[model samples]
Target: MSTPTTVALPTDMELVLKVFPMPKDSNNNGDIFGGWVMAQVDLAGAVLPARYTCGRMATVAVNEFIFKQPVQVGDLLSFYSKVTKIGRTSVQVLVEVFAERRVLGNQYVKVTEATLTYVAIDENGRPRPLPITELQPRRQY
Candidate 1:
């Protein structure tokens, strides 16, 4: 096995989610499943948009998803996110996942990056315009 590359975490994006992958989430190769990571990314991507939607929203599209490194069991994963665009009824976000390797003295390695779009939805589950009041700057995350 090669030495895991260590890098600094992002300072611009908000740290949205932090999770530790367990053995149950691993695959035959002992690495965490890609699908599981994607699920977490989808959840992480919505954090910022939730503030703007201020009511209800649904994931409209996963514009892009890239897995750069394999995640291992016991790795402490930190998901960071930033809003890339905000349309009248949709919000686009960029999410980056970094792992603090458990076996490598908790060194950080960027493992995944994804772009996802979410649409504000009404109680009936139809798309709706974002609330204007929520668009104004509020407390920072």
Candidate 2:
């Protein structure tokens, strides 16, 4: 098989999660199931927001999700994420999943890309403000 072309991985995004799928995770077509990949993306996308939320959080929405290529078992999957927006009680993040084939050393395929939004929640599950700003050293102090 001809090697797939690759683009340089994002430098600005954080490499939040790196995982590989097992045989049980494969779909009928033998590719890793879409739902399983989405679940991993959801977990990866939350890495950045967790720093700000500093409390319970919930995934409020998957604003956009696109599977550009199929993933197969044994392919090394790398999830990169960046925070796109930080609201008073919510954060929007962009996640990109790349598949690195063992045969194609140093090459990566853009398998999936998604945008997700998460909300910081209080003990009762109501929206809560991000605790990040409060952690900054006060100028008045």
- The candidate that achieves the highest lDDT relative to the unseen native structure: 1
Off by over 4 Å in 1: 1-4, 133-141
Model 1 gets an lDDT of 0.90
Identify the leading candidate in terms of TM-score: 1
For model 2, the superposed segments whose C-alpha errors exceed 4 Å read 1-4, 133-141
Candidate 2 lDDT, 49-128, residue by residue in tens:
88789889999999999988888888999999988888899989999999998767757988999999999999999999
What CA root-mean-square deviation does each model show from the true structure? 2.3, 5.0
Window of ten residues with lowest summed lDDT in model 2: 132-141
lDDT for 54 (candidate 1): 84
Instruction: Write down the lDDT of every candidate, Cα atoms only.
Output: 0.90, 0.88
lDDT of 1 by residue, 34-128 (tens): 99999999999998899889889999999999988899888899999988888999999999999998677878998999999999999999999
Candidate 1 steric clashes: 0
TM-score of 1: 0.91
